[model samples]
Target: MQGRSIPAPNDWAAQFWSPIVGAEAQATRETVAMYDMTALKRLEVTGPGAAAFLERLCTGKVAKSVGSVTYTLLLDHDGGIRSDITVARLARDRFQVGANGNLDLDWFSRHLPADGTVQVRDITPGTCCIGLWGPLARKVLQPLTDEDFSNEGLKYFRAKRAYIGSVPVTAMRLSYVGELGWELYTTADQGLKLWDTLWQAAKPLGGVIAGRGAFNSLRLEKGYRSFGTDMTYEHDPYEAGVGFAVKLDKDDFIGKAALQRRKSEVRRKLTCLTIDDPHSVVMGKEPVYDGGRAVGYVTSAAYGYTIGKGIAYAWLPAELAVPGTPVRIGYFDQRIEAVVAEEPLFDPTMSRLRG
Candidate 1:
């Protein structure tokens, strides 16, 4: 499990573990791929006030039944996007929060109620995660355990406690790469065994151990936004292209009033651009020009191996965000031609993910 490694955003893991990222990216599309997602911050929220506390802070409904997962956002008072997180209700009084990083942990810790009815604990150090995804993900996993991994048995956005071989795991039916899969979690002591078990089972099925490089390319193709790279506190859910996660009809939550006021006033947006030339690519933070004037900058960019084009997400004026609007990205000495394209560039119908 070694190759050329690069520094990741988090200090605990490498940006990539393999040299050939394209092959890994292809594996995720054509077959199964295992990703080391241990760098993802994991948190445990428990106590009598767990559901109420989370519902107050999250924009989406968090007070759901056990084994349910909700993709939600943590917003600031000004309706700015703080973090996009997933809240999994493990029990009546317990939740597993899949969050960004230390900043999210700090945000949750700072907002704890004075009555001490809720407890937030960092669980990253004690837990590890493996993201097994692709068309054959269920095939690779089903034989290892008795638990039903079928679409009907463990549906999307759901969580179930199960065992993979001898390793106890909590499997969440979700995918960052827009593929059919589950994020399998286990204790640190069982991490090695879990990885080995999956790898051995998937070997005959043509599964590859992928890295962050392929993961980034896959997610961008799916139009998934990374918290810090594609958005920040300055952007709102609408402008960030994640307004679907915001439920204004729900009861009072953080930034509810501000979001209501800002909903109809969006002036800018995180727009998707596709390079005209399939070979041309930008490395992000490059200036984007509308006509002759620079109007925005690229936030995240990757070569869409699956789509046979270059993809970049950039911040642009609302008028320039329309599909088919032409733009140019300044990459060092060259200005590459691109156009505002409808996302996600791949799997717009999400049939692959649902299967």
Candidate 2:
């Protein structure tokens, strides 16, 4: 998190993380399989005090029992989401934090203690990650590791040590897939080797290599919030309806007070909307209207293939967030028709996690 200049769009983020392939090929669709966020500075927190520091600073508990990949929000004293990160608990003494935005990396760096019992290091250059998703994901991955994924305890937010070739790895049941998937995390030197290894194992399952665009579509369809986009420092967990990730009952933590107060005082809330017309898509920052008055603005909008329509997340007034509320989203010259609906246009019951 050295405040390097932001990377230009379509840069070689994947190559930096997984250096097995040539830069040109890594930047392309064959090996990368998705958008390259490898440019995001990686930070490693380890040693005796890391867990205690995280428990006080982050929304989720970072203790040993919950040593799995978890979604957490870093907040200021005022309870806004400064960064939404995925915490990968590698072991009792080590953990990794993956963030979507660079600013959060700086935020975490500034807060570390000077005594050094808890240490933080930038490991972006040394780590590589690839996500295997879709229905056949687990079946495709079973051959690469010796652990039994079919074991009942290999549930979501869980992980265990495994190996591919000679390199040690941590296979975590974490993904944006809304389906059964795993994130293969290992050293940078072995990144491409692991990717090629997995590709060979996964090809027989008819697995489609996923890209950033498709990954974004799948996540947004499930109403997952993207850091710096759909969610920001201005929004609290309560309004985002991610309260499960925030354990208010736990011992004191940062932003706990503000979150408790904001629970009932939220004026506008994040909710999902579907365009009445499938052909009409509502883009972000479009004005959302009720009658002649503009009540809210669209934060994230996309065409959902599963629901077969335009779906979006908007910060609508709490009263207007009802399931049947009629709203309109504006385009350049024409306004698109839409309605407010409960988020998660697909599988509200969360059935896909079991598949």
Candidate 3:
């Protein structure tokens, strides 16, 4: 794909917390809710060779069926993750990739072909996004669109174009918080209409506005990883416990060869742990101990409201990264007792998100 010059980012990210008002706990537990996702960069890949071009650039299969979304990674030459991204196949000739920053755009600039058969355009400034989450999300959104939003009609990881209250939008079924949710993406000009409409519909159904804090707690409860913090260029997929997302058998792509070799030889593996002391919450980067020695460290952590424990992720020796494996996490003056817990503490089966 031929890539365009990067567009300057909008200020929406700075406004995410300013206008929000309500108890964030309500957004996590029930109702349909909204989260300002404008901070994430969104880009469009289009033209004849869009799919094939992206297939070569990412670890996951990007030439997917239309209207589907794939969670994939852009890796360095040595199988280290450069960026984790989401690609939605909007149409036969169109794809949208979203991530936290400009790294993906830099990749495009370096690799996209000069020919016009494929093209990449940064759409971050012109687009805005808000997510509808929790149990009542579907119900609250159904009235605003003509499309079928029932479980059978709009399945997880699927995307489709529609309109909400006169604003054209693309809605995708996804869950970062382990609940039924749709992230509604709209043009910047229609952003206000989109948010107001969704908010108006959500009020009667018990929905509330959520900030980044709610997302932190919700995502941790679900064992979701934050790209730079939990999985990065220093950590391979196998060591990060996300090897399942890699398809090594596919036609050769970046990181394929190195990833294959590291698969079974992984010395350290990522896993979840829970602290017994609720008051001593670990906000991450704490040292983990085994037999009075520092064995590993935490990558991400938060208080999981649903599980009612301080949830954490750390890379430990493969043998110690097991359920009920006792350990200790050290802060300044305290060493909190902990146990390796099964991940996705809220819904291990993933039924809630699927529903």
How does model 3 fare in lDDT? 0.81
Q: Please report how far candidate 1 places residue 39 from its true position, in Å.
A: 0.8
lDDT of 3 by residue, 1-355 (tens): 1122212222432212322222454454566678888778999999998988888888888787898999988888788888888999999999999876888798877887778788889999999999888888888888888888888988999999888878999998987888898888999999988899988998877677887876887888888889988887888888887776788867888888888877778888788999766566576788999979999999887666566666789878989998999999987777889899887788888887898
Across 1-355, the per-residue lDDT of candidate 2 in tens digits comes to 1111222222322212321222221222122232234455567889888888788778987665645777877888999888777777878878888776557667767877788878877788888777776666666667677777763757778887888655677777776746667777788888878777877776665445556555655677778888777878889887876777898877788899998898889887888888756556465888888887888888877555556566788888889999988888876667777888876776688766664
Q: Judge candidate 1 against the unseen true structure and give its global Cα lDDT, from 0 to 1.
A: 0.91
Give the per-residue lDDT digits (tens) of candidate 1, residues 179-224. Answer: 9999999999999999999999998998899988899999999999
Candidate 1, TM-score vs. the true structure? 0.94
What does each candidate score in C-alpha RMSD?
4.8, 8.3, 8.4
TM-score: the better of candidates 1 and 3: 1
Number of the predicted model whose lDDT against the real structure is largest: 1
Error of 1 at 150 (Å): 0.2
Where does candidate 1 clash, by residue pair? none
Candidate numbers, best lDDT first, in rank order: 1, 3, 2
TM-score of each: 0.94, 0.86, 0.91
The TM-score between candidate 2 and the true structure equals 0.86
CA lDDT, candidate 1, residue 207: 89
Number of the predicted model whose TM-score against the real structure is largest? 1
